[model samples]
Structures are given as C-alpha cells and as structure tokens.
Target: MERNFMTTTKPFVIIGAGIAGVHAAESLRNEGYEGRIVLIDRDTQLPYDRPPLSKEYMLGESSESNIYLRSHESFNTLRIELKLGVEIVSIDAEKQIAITSDGTIIEWEKLLFTTGSRLRQLQVKGSDLEEVHYLKTLSDANNIRSKLDNVQQVVIVGAGFIGAELASSLKKLGKEVTILERMPLPLAHILGEEMGEYFLHLHQSKGVNVITGDSVVQFDGTSQVEKVLTENGRVISCQAVIVGIGVIPNTLLSDEKLDVDRGYVVNEFGETSLPNVYAAGDCAMWPYRGANIHIEHWDHAVNHGKCVAKNMINEKSAPYSAIPYFWSDQYDHRLQYFGHTKDWKSTVLRGNIEDQQFTYFYLNESDIVEAALLVNQPKNALAVRRLVKQQHPVHTDLLSNPDMSLKKVHLRANEDKVSY
Candidate 1:
C-alpha cells in the first residue's frame, strides 16, 4: 500500500489508551507532531497504569491516584483530543476512517492500534455468579477490593502474575487465598520449571493455599459465589472467586485492515502490513531477530511505543530492537527477569536460592548471556539487564562465584563494545 498521503498534516488517530497508546501519544508530541491527535479508548478514566491493578492498589497499600500515567492538564497542553468511554466498532482502511459505536466517523491520515489485551474469561458452568470476578481494569480492581472486607475465603484460578500477585495481596490483608492452577507449578512455562519451583516457594511460604495441576470446573452458588468445583471433582467453599487464566489480543476492530497472526502483524519498525498503520505493545507481533514475537511486558510496551513513534515520523524506519524485561512483586519478594530464552542452552546459578537470595543466568551455546533473572535481589537486576543488553560472553567461573561482583558484566560490556 502506498503511504504517500501519510506525510500530510492530517489528523492521527490512536485506538486504546493503555500504557502503549499513552506513550505513543506522548512520543508523537515530543517528536514535533503538531497535527490533530485523537486518542479514543473505551475506558472512561484517563489512561492509567495497569500493573498496580493486581498489586499495591488491590492491596490498599497504594491509591488509584498514583496509578495514572499522566495528568489531565498535560494532555490538554499537548493539544491531544483524549476521548474516553468511546469504542470504535469498525475501520475503513481504504477511506482511512473509523466508525465508532455512537456513529461518529473519525477520519485519519495515519492510525495506530495499541488496543492492548483483554482477560480470557472462564467458560465453565455457573461462571457468571455475582462475586466471581476478573481483574483487567481499575473499576474491576475497585469492585474486587470493595468485597474483600466481607470475604474471608477466596479461590483464585490460574497462577500467572496477576493471580499470584492478587493471592499475595489478599493473604497479606488477612484473607485466606486458595490459588488453583492447571499447570504443575506457578510460572513454569515462562520462567522455567526450576525457577517455577521458586515461585511456588514464594507463595507457599506466605500461607497461601496453592493447588496446581487442576482447574475450576464450576463456580457454585445460588446468587453470590460460595463454592468452587475443580476439574478433578474436588469442592472448595469460598466467599468469592477470581479467574485469571490469561488474556487475548484486542484486535477485533483491525482484522480487516491488518493481517492477524497471533497478533496484528508488524515489521521490525512496528509498521503493519498496511502502510502508515502501525501497531505496538500487546496487540502487535513485531519482528525480533528473524521472527515476530508478541510481548506483553510493561517495559516492552514503553520501548515499542517510543520506537514506533520515532519510526512513524522519520523518513526511513529504524528497526526496533530491545530486550524484554519485567518485575513481579509478591509478599516481601521482588523477582525481576530480563531477556527471553531462545539461543540459550545452559543455566548458571549465582546465589544460594535456598538462602532466599539468587540470580540465574541463561547462557547460549556460544557462552553469551541470553537471559538473567534476579530473585529477591533488586540491586542486581540492573546489572543483569545491562549484561543482556550488551550480549557479551560471560566468564562462567567468575559469574557463578557469589563473592564476585555482579558489576563485572560492565567490564565485559566495555570490552565487547570496543573493536580490536
């Protein structure tokens, strides 16, 4: 498709106002995009940070006020038309326009779909019972928190980050939390089975009742949820239930305009198959290395937004390449992971995890560190991130020594950057 018309100063429209969308809007203005910028989201609240919806905000350790991405004044100052509570039903790629739910026709020369992801709901019997909940928005979190006081026992389905964090939060609030996961161990698929066992340790030590390798088959109650039925015919009575199985890409509107393969297919520059129609964050499957990968990490969203924004304005697109990173907070433990394991074949253990402190490194066949994880060690997480960024081979003997400084990765970075 020809993008010759995209250079015009016509209005630019962004769908969804999550972290990726908000950052893209901010980046546009920062890159001297003085054109009319219209951002529409189904959410009424000014785009807010979502990570806290399952963490401190849900635990009452933090307030919703602190979770907002930007002040209302800033959006106004940037001349951004922030339209919330508006849903776009269809897109006309040929006409370069969008038809919203309320029959509003929005024309645009260029568009960005940062539609993000939505919760994959429970499809079991009696799943629609009142008191059974799913956390994806601030409103949902508020509803969950409002009922926490009266609820003593809660059943949480799935053991992903959201479920695990909520379980940790509820347990800290003096509520009994029973987590049910169909997988054998928590976070096994993402963090590896060995590290998955560590995640199990984190929640189990906190007194949260974790039931793995099983799923809730039914949420039973007359009106409000009072009991949960597992796939194995085990019955557990609880005052409420939280289903956090997973999420699906919110790409229904852009199906006709973009090629959908796992997610809206995008090049390394975040430009979709359609000219000037770019995608980023959770809804975009952008090229990494030689293949496309769909990432949902907060850091990836921020970086993708900034990179795509720059590419949108530049005459020549620059390939977006950045290592993925994300952190999880559970109880008193803070776990941080950097990079994805693909080329890596060997795992090196750094600290004594049995002693409640450790960092693991995933090394490729060439001995370059491909991924690093810091458990209960926030201070060293930055070092691992830098090591991944540098992509330099590590001296295994030194890296495995607990007494050796993690900062040694910096020296390796310097050596790798310099050519002989």
Candidate 2:
C-alpha cells in the first residue's frame, strides 16, 4: 500500500538529518505529503550512515560516497528543502515554531525531532589531552582514522559495540588494545551474562586484552594520554585513549515539557506529551512491544521515525509496535539479536560453536523470549523472531535436535501444541 500523506501548502519541518530524519522525510513523500518539506541538520553535509564509519570506512573498504544516505537529486526530486549546518536552538511549542542558532525562526504545523545523539564525554584529568578521542561524528571518525598510524597501545574505556568494534579494527592494524568495561562481562546487560561470556572468549581469543569490572578514574600524562588509572588503582600505559562509554540524546532544543528519562520519553506512537511535536532516533525513548519499555536501538529509531511521520499527517494511524532488532560486526563474526531477553530464565544454543555458526535462543519458562545469531544464519533468526513474537512454546526435544530446523519446527506444529 502506498503510504502517502495529504498534500498541504504549509511545510512540515523536521529537525536533524540523520537516518531517522531522512527516513521521516522519505516517508512523508511516500505517504503522499507533497507539501513543502524542510529537513534541518546541524551537520554541514547530508545525512550519512554511521555504522560504516567504525567498520568499513575505518578499514578503507568503503569510501565517503558509500556512506551518504540520500543524494541531492533525490531530495530535490522529493521537493525537500535541505537546511544544512543550521542548528535548531529552541522550540516554541505554543507558537508551533523553532528558532535556529542564527536567530532565524521557522513556523511549522508538525515538527519531528530526530536530532540523534552525541558521544558521552569523559571528565577527568588528561581528558583534554591531544590523543584522547570519542567517536561519534564523521569528523571524529576522520580524526581517529588519521591517528591510527601513531597509536600503538590503545585504551578503550567501554566494552560496548563501538569499543568492541574499534578493538577489532585496531587489532587488524596490529595495535595492542585493552578494553576496560565496568560490567563483569562485555555486553552482559544487552546479550545476557552467558552469551556475553562467550563474546569475551571470542575477543580474548583474538588477542584483545579484555579488562572487566574496572572503570577509568583518571588519565595521567603530560601533553597526551600516556597512562590510564582505573578505579582499582591499576595504571595501564597507552599511547591513545578512545572512550566509548555511551551516548546522550540531544534534546536541549525542546522547551516543551516532555517526559525525559535517560532519553526523551515517548509513547508507542513516538508522541511526546506535547501536541504536534514528535521525536524519533537515538534521541527518542519509544516503547518496545516485547519488553513493554522504551528502548534505544537503531531499528527502533528508523521505525519510530516512519511511525511518527505517518501519524503526524494521518489521524487514523496505528501505534508503533515493532520489535527491537540490532546487529554488530566484530572481526569475522556477525552478531544479530532480536527482541528483549532481559528476563529470560534459560538459553539454548543451536549448531556447533566450533563451526562458528550458531543461534542462541533465550526462553522465559516455556515461552521463547529472544534470539541472537552469530555468523550469517538469517533464516534461524527469522524463525526464532516469529516464535518469540507469538510467544510459542518450543519443545525441548525439537530445540535440542541439531537436525530439526527452526522453520520446519515452527511451521509443522499447531498453536495448541506450541503454546505454553
């Protein structure tokens, strides 16, 4: 079905030209909203995919051209007025207008805030050093890439996706890497402790110094980052420091009182407390179906963007109820995870770990709750996602059988036999 919006004379202003904002603009056109569309971004260039920056772009496998999400011609064809390098300073909800950094005011009937996020800063001694870096923006990536030659012993402050990926990337360049994570295991909270332990092994096997249960208290150096002092009083020497702790949503422009949690709180429809103003992307904290809690994921961001745009133009739109999904590429392994399994009681691993192709399914009692696959077994992920969504009761015998495919198992059984 064509998801087009009604053509109105007044322009629909969208802030931030990230993936979410770009998708929202395209979704507006696809919904038949042929009216004036304004896409404002603080970046001097057009919106680009950030995932490639740490992986392909850093390795020189992909160029800058491959990172561009939309071309100028595409925006021109869609009649989108691109406002690059203009920062939205503040928003007046009552007036339905936004003032830019240059004091230019623009009125809008509906506003979509896709301002995304910025990298969390580290406030400590030697944080202002020349070699200390935080990767978030394209410029930051460029700077990091340039310094790769001089970086010998790299200290990563967090063991999150960015930190892990950077460790793998720098390892490929023959750099000694040490990852310091406060959690007991890397990705322990997101992928659960057991699976996180497996990942720890994977990183250590690849010669990465995985340091957990430690936090960087301070950096001791003269003009550059020379040593990192942890909370445990252990000092580690490093030529460069890359802090990948986390990110904070950029929501300072919104003057209206919206529910702000760790991020900007929004309902299932990506609607904040304010009327006519919506949010999406990393800046948004929208609800997840399975977890029934607001989550921050790339998939959630894109989905929320489309949902918010559609609801802004249409009155009879459905609420955002998509499952949260995300993936990470580290070394040669492809990690794909779907749904939330924070409360899962049991986890089953399918396929051989030695073969490097397996799917880990997390179950709560008898219900399949979540699944994560390593390597490129997308079919298994799809089948498990369906079972999780339907809350189907998976048989222990069938799940344990290496010969029995998840697709066949799911399709052959009836709901009565599959129910918990």
Number of the predicted model whose TM-score against the real structure is largest: 1
Candidate 2 colliding pairs: 3-30, 3-31, 4-30, 4-31, 4-32, 5-31, 5-32, 5-33
lDDT tens readout by residue for model 2, 127-219:
898889888878888898898888899999999999999988888989999999999999888777877888899899999999999998899
| Over 4 Å off, model 2 | 1-9, 290-292, 371-376, 412-414, 417-420
Number of the predicted model whose lDDT against the real structure is largest: 1
- The positional error of residue 407 in candidate 2, measured at the CA in angstroms, is 1.4
Question: What lDDT does each candidate get?
Answer: 0.85, 0.81
TM-score per model over all chains: 0.94, 0.92
- Model 2 TM-score relative to the real fold: 0.92
Q: Local error of candidate 1 at 224, Å?
A: 1.3
Residue 78 lDDT, candidate 2, scale 0-100 = 90
The list of candidate 1 runs beyond 4 A from truth reads: 1-9, 255-257, 409-420
